[model samples]
Target: RKQLVYSSCRAESAGKALADVMPDETVHNILLTASLCMGFSAFSYEFMPTGDARRFNYIAMAMTGFCTIGYVSMYNGVGVIEVRGHDVFWMRYLDWAVSTETFLLGLAMLSGADRWDTIFILAMDAIGVLCALVGALIPAVVAPAYLLGAVVFAAYNYRLFGTMQVSADRMGAAVSAKYKRLTTQSMAAWCVYPVVYLFCEMTRALDETTEVALYACCDVIAKCVCCFLLLSQP
Candidate 1:
């Protein structure tokens, strides 16, 4: 009887955690989510010391970051419940963030590219998104699509980093250092996203409770934490 009662309580607690948007937030996380998105967007275009040559690129990247909260919210966004608790796991769908970001990020990286670079990046993005969206539509292709995206991403970042070198030269030493830091952090965060997607959305061994918890943690790391890191750079 005691074991049964304990199990039932755990189930209830998990359910409540998924259902509530607030548990113990210092500030409502949804609002914080929005704020971070907007904050990063504003800083990227307005305040950051980036040159005008990459202005369009900055806009594309900023928009990608701004819109990514949609995916985060869909997965399991959090909010403050009271002073002592927090709410999470309100939704699900790990691929949304990854798929969408792949396309936009490619374009953002493509900004200021010459014809050949532009064509290559666009072609790869189209294929990558096709795989991801088709998998999303069919559910059967999701896992394979993620694997394919990893391959494309390796190429994408390689070429993009090469192009960024030109921009880095134009931006100068102090500002270029900041750009390098931001790129490194952003790319590192992106790597975490796919791992979460695989575990939470692809594999079936983990239960919904554990999957959602992992998704929640990784989502914050990839989105919010990266945003602050970008802001902190001089």
Candidate 2:
């Protein structure tokens, strides 16, 4: 259903064009990542009132907490390796920063998420469409910066799933493999924002938001309808 909307709206075509032009698979990954991430986000906001920045933040923190626990447990089982005192402090600081950032982003989204603006919302939707188009049309050289931006900005998602492991206590090997797959997939999701942002910037670079806007409007209607249903629900 999501892919249908993406395709019917012509985003897939754009992506194909971008993919054709760029030889790198990273471009395609970034393109798909952006579409999936932003599409999920737009869908959630549109259809599920409970889905918002707050939910995103909560999920982020939960993942991070689990990863931290997993890391600690694994270290204990392995017998602690001694680190210089300064290194310990640095690692502790990094952990603190990751946890705090997760909490804060959630808090920020929850406490003061702006009223859903149609233009901005549509603009967000446009991001994926543009990425698809650019990736297909432009040189691969354009991908790295967007990749970097995604890494810098959405880096928190990485820590959230970083330390997850399959435990022998309960799940079978199949379950463990599935969990590992999920963790890796989650890590991939962390890059979606950079792809979307980069794609939008690329289109904006070409002064082509006008065409992108058309594709974006299809998503806009879907989102607005979702928002309406959410409002109508008791």
lDDT of 2 by residue, 1-234 (tens): 998897777977866654443313432343333334334544444333443334653444343443244223322322112222100112222332343334333322322323332223223323433433334344453475444434434333333223223131134664345444443443343334344334444434322333224323332332222222223322
Q: C-alpha displacement of 179 in model 1, angstroms?
A: 1.8
Which tens-of-lDDT digit does each residue in 53-82 have in candidate 1? Answer: 354445444544544554444434442222
Best by lDDT: 1
Candidate 2 whole-model C-alpha lDDT, 0 to 1: 0.35
Clashing pairs in 1: 22-81, 23-81, 23-85, 23-86, 23-87, 24-85, 24-86, 25-80
For all predicted structures, in order, the TM-scores are 0.53, 0.24
**Candidates' RMSD to native:** 10.2, 21.9
Q: Candidate 2, which segments miss by more than 4 Å at Cα? A: 1-154, 166-172, 189-192, 206-234
Residue-pair clashes per candidate: 8, 6
